[model samples]
Target: MDQFTNFTRKVSANLTPFAEKVGTNFSQLRQIATEKMSNSAIITELPREYVETENRFEPVKHIHADLVRLARKYALDEGNVDFNKLQNQFIEITSSIGEKITNLASQNPQQQNTQNQTQNAYKPLNVTIQHQLASACISNSEIVGASLYKFGSTYEKIGDFRVKMNHDILENCINLLQGEFTSNIELAQKSRKDVQGARLALDALKSSLKGASSSKQAATAIEIEKAEEVFIIAVQDSMKHMKFVLGSPIIIESLRNFAAAQLEYFKESQSLLETLVTELEEIKLTQDALYYSEVDHH
Candidate 1:
């Protein structure tokens, strides 16, 4: 009998906290329903400091979201061409060139040198319509002559610069902005939710105070004071979190990095293209003079 009594005491001890929690939850639910039905429950006004902090946070949140979106779009901005598809096509075309050369060399073993030259000569023209024309131009210029090859090489450098610029934007700007949103903004939001829950709990306890019997009124009032303290602390914590995010310089720094990367890319591309244009003009004049000389001779 003593053992059974001890066992029963242990079970009750284990269940006591759970029972209390369930009871508190039920009371809160009942209070919520009563207030919803009658609208007689007094709504507690938040402190002015908390209200001001919340107002300040609103614009920061809006701007942060907008910055994140703009950064992502800038990182991925490929005008009309599908960059991934073009890269894949370039890979496929280059890989096939090696395979075709190997097959031709094997099929005409005695005449491998002649066949290799002929096959390589025909390869560039074959890929012009199906692949990136700039890449095809590079292959063709390599076989035909040196002047066109230099122009194709400059064009290739521009393509490479664009790819590097996008990568830098994604790595340094977009990713940094996203990290701020996740680490700072989301944490502040969670703190705000905690403040709301603490406020609700304090409000629920205050509502219960009016119905307390004379014997329980003193203790109930004390509980209400403790709940009020908890709510105040929650508000302060939330305010601190929100302020940290608002005051952070990461957003501005990321934007600056993004702009700097773009500026460098454009500057380099413009320099290369301008030089190429001058060279092409000189080549065009020389070709024109040669054509006139041949016409006069005929």
Candidate 2:
């Protein structure tokens, strides 16, 4: 995140001057378009600032000088001019700007963005097409604001179509991020449920084993057998619930690995019980000592 912040800062710094120059050019064009003159479109034949014109057509001169200034400023800022790439594009845009402004003076308010275009009035398909394109462009993973504007037409009412486009893209990005967040949350809930079930099963199993180990002098063998049977049934019930909770492939694999290790410990405990019973069955102390010695050696 810190790295991303640093990268954005550097980008913003580099774009600042470029943004300023573009703004200046935009203002100059707006001023020229809005100017009112007696016999011509320009108010002052010669710009008060620039004074290099001789006997050339004055408005044409301003337009020429403005274009040169724009080209020079752009070149200085960029450090290189790619005429092969940008010259034709420049001519096309300048011509479009001239036509748009000319139409605006004739009461056809410049239809800057698609949304603000009035000629397509009463056309529902146009509206639908505009909205769908906007949605897809904004939601697209590959495009950002500038790319959308460079490749697509935008509206004046849509206002800095780049900004609106970015906002829409951001909304889609939020929805995508939220989906990941929700998936993680669900996984965490499942993990917690599995852990709780396993814990309860383990506790019940421990308690039952403790009860079996704590049996002392009791009634008949059948009664003792019934007591152990009851404990085993209770333990089996707990294990069934644990298995249900761990039925998922991921959980089952983990349980299989864990149970493999734990089953040995229970077997060792059973072996210890068998050894004690074997010692108890011996009638003589010598016999008990011999059996104990053999079991310890084994």
* Worst ten in a row by lDDT for model 2: 46-55
Candidate 2 residues 1-298, lDDT tens each?
9999999999999999999767645644444444432233323222222122211223432443354344333322233223342334334334454565566456522243333344336322212233345434533414443344322333221212222222222233223333443344345345434433333333333333433643532433444365345535544443443333333243233234334434543464455446545554543466669879999999
What is the lDDT, from 0 to 100, of the residue 68 in candidate 2?
Answer: 38
Clashing pairs in 2: 113-154, 113-155, 113-156
Q: Return the lDDT, model 2, position 78.
A: 38
TM-score of 2: 0.22
lDDT of 1 by residue, 170-242 (tens): 6677778778565888899999987866776777777878877889889988988998898889989999999
Error of 1 at 74 (Å): 2.2
The TM-score values for the models, in the order shown, are 0.66, 0.22
Task: State the displacement of the C-alpha of residue 22, model 2, in Å, after optimal TM-score superposition.
Answer: 71
Best by lDDT: 1
Q: How well does candidate 2 score on lDDT at residue 101?
A: 53
Best by TM-score: 1
